[model samples]
Target: MDRFARIDTLINNARIFISRPSNRDTEGDVTAVLGVNIAGHITQLAAAHDRGGR
Candidate 1:
């Protein structure tokens, strides 16, 4: 904040879809879903701050 001192725009398009309980626990499913759905967004948001936002 002190560096750039402002922000203009921010976008987080991470998403996940699980229609069944079995699908949620399958191999690679949890990592894929959580990685794209949550981890990715958190990473991008953190980058925004470090890079002066946008």
Candidate 2:
């Protein structure tokens, strides 16, 4: 789907996520969550911008 593609693009594109592997995540839970949140913001902004700032 386009949404999945957008996510891939977001992850692959220039981005800065505060995700860090931790014990709970067996890696970085906080970092992962932060990155996801940031990505969501980015995606929403992109969508809004594309809609003529609507």
Candidate 3:
């Protein structure tokens, strides 16, 4: 924001994939994956929109 003064485009290419058997997956593990895959994207999108970018 300081250097560019504004945002033109936002690219969200960050993600995490955890492969495990359902029986081995814990609540915390699922929460973490959701937080990164879903919440993370929403947060980025909101930030980009606030910065007047696509």
Better of 1 and 3 by lDDT: 3
- The lDDT per prediction is 0.71, 0.54, 0.73
Q: Look at candidate 3 and tell me the lDDT of residue 30.
A: 84
Residue clash pairs of candidate 2: 18-31, 19-31, 19-32, 20-28, 20-31, 21-27, 21-28, 22-27, 22-28
In model 2, where do residues sit more than 4 Å from their true spots?
Answer: 1-27
Candidate 3, 20: how far from true, in Å? 1.6
Tell me how candidate 3 scores on lDDT. Answer: 0.73
lDDT (tens digit, per residue) of candidate 3 on 1-54? 667765566666768677877779889888887877886676676586676785
lDDT winner among the candidates? 3
The TM-scores of all predictions, comma-separated, are 0.46, 0.40, 0.47
| Ten residues in sequence with the least summed lDDT for candidate 3 | 1-10
* Higher-ranked by lDDT: 1 or 2: 1
> What's the ranking of the predictions by TM-score, best on top?
3, 1, 2
Model 1 agreement with the true structure over 6-48: per-residue lDDT tens digits: 5555567768887887734887888788788877666666676
Q: Can you tell me which runs of candidate 3 are displaced by over 4 Å? A: 1-11, 43-54
Model 2 per-residue lDDT at 27 = 43
Clashing pairs in 1: 9-54
